[model samples]
Target: MRAHADAFIAYATDPDPRVRRASIEGLGLFLEDAERAVGLLQERLVHESGVAERVLVVQTMADLVLRLPAAAAPARAWFDALADSGSTDADTRLAALAHRARCAPDSIDDRTVPVVIELLRRVTPAPPPEQDPAPDDRRPSRCVHVRPRRRAIRLFPGTSPQHSTTSNATAGSMPPTPLLKALHEALGARFDDRKALLTEQLRSADRATRYDAIDMARRLIASWRGDHTDLAVHSPM
Candidate 1:
């Protein structure tokens, strides 16, 4: 196991995507030593730039938690830090959100809520570029309409989170647009105050802020039962 783990760590940043992917898959063999495996994946995440490779590592951590819930604290802590770090990339942050939703929803706290909201507001796809009409020659040129395809929803399915190099891991479906579904799951029912805070952010002039506000408001409304009586009433409120 040590030899295999060492080899996986060495190849994790291989120039060839295939080699890197193979190394990511091979890391699954070390789940018996989940703390060590989690550490290795965390290291890879810090340096790995390819979206597919990062997704594989994040999903593998989720698998480890699923298989050995008792051993998940290290992995959960890693994700919590990643999700909260402002310097983290959007892809990594999104993966951390999804992993928390899947493996450690109860661990998501007030600190993570604001970070999730900020990330939701910032990650938007740019508009497609307009094309020039073909020059000269002919009858009126017809406009061709191309509809964007809906992304397929794929969940991490393996019990052990380990799969072959060709595993169909995708970053696209990692909490798609809106982001509230994953956030709702991660925040659970103990975040009424945070939900109210996001409600205020809904009134922002910024388009992304308003968009995230609506999604978060919808999530809170859909699940809200009553006020959190355990929370102290502040004088400002």
Candidate 2:
């Protein structure tokens, strides 16, 4: 395996795309060869240009960095390039930056968050206004029983706060702690309170508040439905 490791690294930089692709595929078989695998992939990233191919390389590089922290430096420049302002493809840039942020080294400063949020804003498509239900005469309910309505109804799904991620105050990867749970719940409630306060501001004649509300609504919808096809299909108002 050691003898062929060098050979694989050579093939990884082959001029033929097929050989390069095969080298990437073969690297997956050797988890014990992190140095060799990453070295080979890093070489390919220099010349890789196809959108789809670069995406795959980025994903694979993320996995490598997370699994082999020692190899992170090699990927740092690539991630910086991906998150650059000149990046045109929002999806690629966002995915690359998010993966790097999640797998960053302990000493690494967290600057990728805003870049990711911006990329998310750029990639998210706007939601169209809800359609009015058909009139009673033209109703298509259950095929023949459906009815139409004159008014359009947009349904907003309420947030469910019961779920918790690892970083959430309530539940963490370690043992359950009462103090942590209390803090988490308090923070969640506080967030709800702040949102209500903004709502009240919007209710008044505050023009800025109204604009902020509009922006927040768009972002909330985008975050909730970004990766969810089901929500897109059944957005009940």
Candidate 3:
């Protein structure tokens, strides 16, 4: 356990996106030492680039707070400052607001309300128009048709399809981003209203909205029963 935790801490900054994500999720194992985990995550946030990584770190901190409030005081303070800081990037601030809303609603008021409202209103930009295909690309090429002869099939009398496989176990799994995971943990079992809202967002035409909705749903279901066992098993790694 110690070795794995150490490896995850090192891989937090790994160049590969999958590795980084797995490492971030693995940090949840340190929930028993919230201060240490939160502090490490905060440090990673400062150095982390990319939207996904930032979102995950913020969500993980929120999850820590929700699961271990007494031990997550430092994490709460960190979010408070991040949300209020003018120099922080817009996305990070948005994540901070979302985390606070999920884990500590009372902390949100007039000052943060407008910010959250604005973030929810933000939209992804439309993609640029594609160039028309060249004239030669307009039609399919003509080819001679030939029917191939069928080969004899061999029957394994005792064998059927391998229906019982690990593939089936993973079919319904959708790993949530860090932010979504935190929201799920924080919301606990009372997420009907939030679930409905996220479902609406899932149907949105905007790519960003859809992405957020999917991530949120993944986490919501993962922590639905307030059991972190499965979530831990499928952590980013």
The local distance difference test score of each candidate is 0.58, 0.45, 0.58
TM-scores for every predicted model = 0.53, 0.43, 0.54
Off by over 4 Å in 3: 1-3, 126-237
Can you give the lDDT of residue 205 in candidate 1? 35
- lDDT per residue for candidate 2 within 1-237, as digits (tens), equals 645656666776778866766665444344456676676666665577654445456556766776767667767666777667474466456545655654563322334334433443343333355687657756454646556442222111111234221111111111111111222223232333323322332332323223333434344445443333332233322
Q: Which 10-residue window in model 1 sums to the lowest lDDT?
A: 160-169
Residue-level lDDT of model 1, residues 1-237, one tens digit each, is: 755567776786788977887767666655467777777778887777765567678777776777766658888778777777788777678778767776776666666666655554444333246577657654685898888453333333232223111111233423233234445555565566455445535533333334434545655655676653322232112
Instruction: Flag the better candidate by TM-score, 2 or 3.
Output: 3
Candidate 3 structure quality by residue, lDDT tens digits, 141-188: 788788844322221111133411111001112122233334444545
Weakest 10 consecutive residues of candidate 3 by summed lDDT: 163-172
Clashes counted in candidate 3 amount to: 2
* Whole-model alpha-carbon lDDT for candidate 2: 0.45
